[model samples]
Target: MEANLTPQQLWDCALRLLSRRDHSRRELAQKLRQRQFDPEWIEQALDRLEQQHWLADSRFAAVQVRQHVLKRHGPLRIRAELQRKGVGPAEIAQALAAEDPDWFELARLCYRARFGPDERLDMKERARRMRYLQARGFAPDHIRYALESADE
Candidate 1:
């Protein structure tokens, strides 16, 4: 089933995928391979896309970061997700640093939204809230401030 696609067909499929959303080079390659495209032809298609400036890891990472931030996800989760999508470490660092989101504020907002305004929580309740924020990928310090402070 995979071997029937000509190079043009494979290239067209790649473009269709990119048309829907940005994809890192590795991600695009993986998608093509999954569709049963020939490995050699997939590489050629990727190289062509790269040369034409249609496929870029940096652009993909930037878009992913923006979307994740809008969804209220933390830096740790965004970084891990980008890495999972096969973005390189340097690009990941650059993409994360380029954005200037208030991580502490984000944590607070997420906590409040999830558990509501800070009532006088018992130790177990406080710990539970802390765990929730932590699972959302906030750092410990940010979680502490979110759980302990009354700053809205």
Candidate 2:
């Protein structure tokens, strides 16, 4: 179906979509395409939103990182998710770097919460926990630290 939306209508639709959640430019473009918006109009609308500071990959990455961290997700998982959401590598790097110190701490807390006290995990259990944490995007160093400093 052809989209009969005027530029203003498309802009409004974009804003409403953004209001529900922050979207990367590519994501927004895809959404507009799904809605059958003209490709050129979609690009124009994206540009307008960016000029207005309504759509920013950096901001989206930051908010996504904050949410994932609060949800106890590891950096690897966060980075993967951001990439899936179409955030650029540079923005992802910047966002991840900004959370470097606290990222490990968050992973540690999540590990403890999921696996219980460190002493409770045996070698097999430790390996299992490590795998789980790694899948969640935690680094090996952080996993090792959590295992080593696990409360008995």
Candidate 3:
């Protein structure tokens, strides 16, 4: 992949990547740069793609949020992940707002699935699970609610 790409070649490569899935402008730019396209070429190609509505950070953020939720991740973790992926704060907020109201329920389901239905973990065990969920980007309130509801 060391060959120099003409402007058209760069554009084609960008489209090939975008056609597979949405990508944040930053993500696409980084990918193009990694392919050794000139910085100027990468910028111009990205601009053209944006003009054609092919690359959209907001769309990428929304899809990422949905996918993370489906994978049993909480809002906190998803938001951080999206931010790290170069999603803007406003788009991240919108994505989080669009997430399911039953997100807490899903987390509870995931917890039960992982630890089994036995809610008899001692205080230390309970705290350890709580810490695990926390590190996974779940809010304390959501984790607490899930643990309590599961106990019931």
User: Once model 3 is optimally superposed onto the true structure by TM-score, how far is the C-alpha of residue 124 displaced, in angstroms?
Assistant: 2.4
lDDT of 3 by residue, 1-152 (tens): 46657778788899899889999998889998888888998988788877888888888999998898878888888888888888999999998888754767877877887787765779999998898788777888889977887787
Clashes of each: 0, 2, 0
Residue runs of model 1 more than 4 Å from their true location after superposition? none
Q: What local distance difference test score does each model get?
A: 0.86, 0.84, 0.84
The positional error of residue 15 in candidate 1, measured at the CA in angstroms, is: 0.1
69-110 per-residue lDDT for model 2 (tens digits): 888888888989999989999999998787664766777788
Best by TM-score: 1
Clashing pairs in 2: 76-137, 77-137
Cα RMSD (angstroms) for every candidate in the order listed: 1.5, 1.8, 1.8
Query: What's the candidate order when arranged by decreasing TM-score?
Result: 1, 3, 2
Q: What is the C-alpha RMSD, rounded to one decimal, of candidate 2?
A: 1.8
Report the Cα lDDT for candidate 1.
0.86
Against the true structure, candidate 3 reaches a TM-score of 0.91
Query: How far is 30's C-alpha from truth in model 1 (Å)?
Result: 1.1
Which of the predicted structures, 2 or 3, would earn the higher TM-score when compared with the native?
3
